[model samples]
Target: GGIITQTPKFLIGQEGQKLTLKCQQNFNHDTMYWYRQDSGKGLRLIYYSITENDLQKGDLSEGYDASREKKSSFSLTVTSAQKNEMAVFLCASSIRWGRGAETLYFGSGTRLTVL
Candidate 1:
């Protein structure tokens, strides 16, 4: 019934360059999150926002920045790209965040490649 859209499905960046990714959801969910996925590292939470204009950093938020400009959109930026690295960035939304209260709907994801 709802969909999450992540823009620029593929990204190519140079080392040390800053790259940005974006997400938009039509579910009107109360919470939105950004996650980074790597081959062996699993999914790591990068940032989350409980509501518009509210930001919360996660374990991997150090090298990233996030913004919830509107309830329907969220954006993430990689402060410094790593050379020859590749990863997938995922965007998700939920009615409310909790251990077992709700399910997270994910976007197709944005794939990043650094040269």
Candidate 2:
């Protein structure tokens, strides 16, 4: 397990458009997570996959989709981009030992802009 990276530092999309974000890692951990960070609120979990080929919705899963096709990557999709919607999507990964996660590392993030 080494580093986690998110692609496209900035993402711009039109209203009602479908947007996708991607995350990649270098054989570091077991679980991956996507979180949405608003202007003021804390980072809200959007989705997570505990194992390869598994996906789970998180607190802010509405209007979004996620997939973990392999251990090295994960992706998220916005079903519909709402005008004026802007936020930072963060990608994180951790090693699951027992019931908790460790060695958690976060990517720089992908900022979304809906116009």
Candidate 3:
């Protein structure tokens, strides 16, 4: 079995400030993703990396940047924290699957609060 780890279970940032989150996995999976979940809302994909050093922008990629520096780690940076915003950022990994049902295992999530 494999595992994924994300640092700093909570994040606090000032409005308009830049914040970063880190994730690591031991699964050796081919795909890793970063997503944002607003209060009571479904997860929205922000960015995904298909391979080391490969980045794919998702529907929610605006105002964010990500990096896949190694096969086991991926990092995401929030370019700006919005006013009165709160969200949980999640990191996930999946094995390579062309089309069918590919399940994603997620991190506990980093809760962010803008003040």
Best-to-worst order by lDDT is 1, 2, 3
lDDT of 2 at 61: 98
lDDT tens per residue, model 1, 1-115:
9999999899999999999999999999989999999998889999999989899999999889998999999999999999987999999999986877469999999999999
- Looking at candidate 1, the ten consecutive residues that score lowest on lDDT are 94-103
- C-alpha TM-score for every candidate: 0.94, 0.93, 0.93
Measured on C-alpha atoms, candidate 1 has an lDDT of 0.94
**Model number with the top lDDT:** 1
Off by over 4 Å in 3: 99-101
Of 1 and 3, which scores higher on lDDT? 1
Residue pairs clashing, model 2: 1-28
What TM-score quantifies how close candidate 1 is to the native fold? 0.94
Over 79-110, each residue of candidate 3 has an lDDT whose tens digit, in order, gives 99898888889999998657753679888888
Q: Per-residue alpha-carbon lDDT of model 2 for 13-73, expressed as tens digits?
A: 9999999999998856788999999998999999999989889889899999998979989
TM-score of 2: 0.93
- Give me the runs in candidate 2 sitting further than 4 Å from their true place: 97-100
